[model samples]
Target: MVFVFGVNFPEQRLASLERFYGVGPQLSERLMARFHIHPTAKIGALGGRQITDLNAELTKLTIENDLRRKIQDNIKRLRDMGSYRGRRHAMGLPVRGQKTRTQITTARRLNRVDRKG
Candidate 1:
């Protein structure tokens, strides 16, 4: 059961042939029609508007622009820090603390590789 705007809706739908206590049968039908609530005999009006609003709120959260700005700002700050060591550490790459003598490998593209080989 869901309550919306101080209105209580039953878990089961109201019978199409039956009349609701406060709302008459015809009035109930009209309310259901206006709100696009399912007319199934077992489930009362589930309040579609409330569900729609909830979905909209979820969409708003997913598309928030402030979160994007914060992420960009953090990346920019990491990039601006002086010194190669600090920059590498901020970017999650191998820093000077790690030994790279024989472990580090560089890429050889077609333009850089020796054609004589």
Candidate 2:
């Protein structure tokens, strides 16, 4: 009776019939008993040894989330706020108003192009 509804006896597959979903524990056990299917019951506490790779998952989720673009937007917002740091960032100058006479040259460096050969 229960065998007709796919009780799954050993490795033998019965006829190709419509599948009946969600059999209760009692019903499943009963069906297993009737069909002579020995259920391999998993006993004892489960040892969770599977570790997820966060870098790969982060890259996958980060693309859809666009976190990199969000950071750039934040930087633009801070620059637009025109705070002391923002002003420095806007002018590409040191925030502490450090003298760039002979120390730093990157920001105040002049490209003296000598065209005389």
lDDT of each: 0.44, 0.39
Q: What is the lDDT of residue 95 in candidate 1?
A: 47
Residue 38, model 1: Cα distance from true site in angstroms = 2.8
| TM-score versus the correct structure, for each prediction | 0.27, 0.30
Model 1 agreement with the true structure over 12-117: per-residue lDDT tens digits: 6353323322345775566546556566634444446645553343344422344445554554555667656446545444545665455433212111112111
Model 2 clashing residue pairs (backbone) = none
Which regions in candidate 2 have their CA more than 4 angstroms from the true location? 1-57, 60-71, 105-117
Query: Model 2, 1-117: lDDT tens per residue?
Result: 222312432223431211233334665465445434445522111112201221232234433226445544554676678666555555656546787566656543421121011
Model 1 reaches what TM-score against the true structure?
Answer: 0.27
